[model samples]
Target: MINAYATLASLVAFAQDRLKNEEKGATAVEYGLMVGLIAVVIIGVVATLGGQLAELFASVSEELPAVTTTTTTGG
Candidate 1:
């Protein structure tokens, strides 16, 4: 029982040391989280404005008059 307890204590200490020393994976995870947050913000802005923009363009197009052109040939 004593040996088992000692092994568990060492294992816990080793895990704590490893966690404190590790940085490479943490940086990659942080970068991924930042990118995900930016993407969510962009999607939200676009979704909110998309309908308004489409309506504005539709109104503008309705206000514009169409133009027709004819060509004449000289003999």
Candidate 2:
């Protein structure tokens, strides 16, 4: 019917207006992109330095002294 068509058209127009006026959705998308970029940079840095960092830790561990534990009983 013609009435049904009119109702559908009005609904579509309302949806279009809401989409145009909305800003929160766009801001959330931008923040998500920034976080993804930061994660990628962190992963790249860790991958590049992983081997050197491991070697540095190994050298430091060699320079440290061993631990000795003693237990005493008292009555």
Candidate 3:
């Protein structure tokens, strides 16, 4: 009976250690998935808005005045 109990305890301990390691790996995988999803969302938004944003900047630039600069040399 005592030997059986010892064997069971060792098995439980081994399983716990393995589960801890697996949890770490699972957490890393979850973070990677989240980053991938965020990247996809950013790409989609940029694709959807790129043309409209370019037109907006072009219109703004057309409305702005050009600047002239003069440089003087000092002795």
**TM-score of each model, in listed order:** 0.42, 0.50, 0.48
Q: lDDT tens string, model 3, 1-75? A: 355456546655655685788554335654565566567667767888999999999987776543212222221
RMSD over all Cα atoms, model 3: 17.3
- lDDT digits (tens) for residues 1-75 of candidate 1: 355456546655655675689743345655565566567667767898999999999987776543212222322
Instruction: State the lDDT of candidate 2 residue by residue for 1-75, as single tens digits.
Output: 355456546655655675789733435654565566567667767898999999999987776543212222221
Question: Candidate 2 at 24: error in angstroms?
Answer: 9.2
Instruction: Output the better candidate (1/3) by TM-score.
Output: 3
Report the number of the highest-TM-score candidate: 2
Q: RMSD of model 1, in Å?
A: 16.9
The runs of at least 3 residues in candidate 1 whose Cα sits more than 4 Å from the true structure, single-residue gaps closed, are: 1-26, 60-75
Q: How close to the true structure is residue 47 of candidate 1, measured as C-alpha lDDT?
A: 90
RMSD of each: 16.9, 17.8, 17.3
Displacement of residue 35 (Cα, Å) in model 3 is: 0.9
Q: Kindly give the stretch of ten consecutive residues in candidate 1 with the minimal lDDT sum.
A: 66-75
Steric overlap count per candidate: 0, 0, 0
